[model samples]
Target: MDEKTGEVLGRVVVTQRVGWCADLVSTMARSLISEHWNTSDVGMLASGEDAEGRALPSNAWMALRRLGWGASAPEGVKVNDRIVRMAQEQAGRTLRSAQWRAELTTGVLTSWPADPAKRTADEWVNVRAAVPGGQHLPSSVIKSRTQQIASFARANGRVPADPFELEGAPGVARMLLLSACDGQQATIECREDDPSRVVLRLQLPVRPDPR
Candidate 1:
């Protein structure tokens, strides 16, 4: 095949699909001709070895180098399909590796979304684990913490103002309060709206160290 014109030359038969052949030809043309070809010239010269008899202008020669000889022209024109295929394959591999690296950095394990929300399965797992009683944390620990909070509220005869009302009890609310408190006084206030629900509010001093 001729890289410039993408025309098969001589009797060298190839079993590859025509599209593959075109890809091969295009690769070779980009590498060998596109960089050097002149854009202004539009004419092609007849294929012959007699430079003096059929010498093309410098600009025409550049275009001709990119175009190769036309389909009806004679033999001896050459194209390296092996090199073309190798270059195309290498380019494909490089692109795939780049995509893989991007996915790895973003924590996308698989291409398909496991949930209807279009999030990956691993992402859903992490989100669930972050929740108070999700599988990511021990169920016993979560239950015990909740029970401690209920007991403390019952004993105080008033719901503790904030999640820290349970004192040392380690629950999601306690974790949040601890993280927000910086060795300063914090207040938790609770208002009972009904038997089933209670509204809780927290107040902390503006200064980092209220002491």
Candidate 2:
């Protein structure tokens, strides 16, 4: 059984009616270690009587402890159904290009523009006036801002240039522009018949689990 995924990777069934010995043998077999000891040797070991009617070897006691006091041992080690489905569901989210970019853009939609060149000082002031908590122009700027914006649009399901222009509306432009500003590969093109209209194209990665 896979502890993380809760998938039953294997199973073991014992028909014996013996008590502690049966449980111990089943557990050891499930753990893939039964072949190491002979059946007669195990019975003698479990008898609990040593030379002069004293206790058995200390090694046997230690082995029992290592097996987790019988019941506490790993569940799959004996039954193979130990891991529940819920355990697998708790693993970290899968790293997906589209999902990752979409999350980033969603965050960007809530943030103010951080670039000075792409956003004029007056524009920044106007935005701040409209959205009181909006962020102002960043002190340092990058020359690849346009490229980054294009890439983000492509990765997040949109055309780069148009995504920037689409958010040009009063207080939302900064957020949209910032979303397009990082970690993606994108391309921008203007309509042949209408130079005023721009098209942003993006490329998204395929998801492994279509469901």
Stretch of 10 with least lDDT, candidate 2: 88-97
Clashes within 3 Å, all models in order: 3, 6
**How accurate locally, in lDDT, is each candidate?**
0.33, 0.32
User: For this target, which candidate reaches the highest lDDT against the unseen true structure?
Assistant: 1
Query: Tens digit of lDDT per residue, candidate 1, span 79-152?
Result: 33332333333322222223322222122212213332344667656534544345555535434444554566
Query: What lDDT score goes with residue 41 in model 1?
Result: 16
What CA root-mean-square deviation does each model show from the true structure?
Answer: 37.1, 29.5
Off by over 4 Å in 2: 1-104, 107-117, 122-148, 152-211
Name the TM-score of candidate 2: 0.18
Q: Which residue pairs come into collision in candidate 2? A: 149-180, 154-202, 159-200, 159-201, 160-200, 167-173
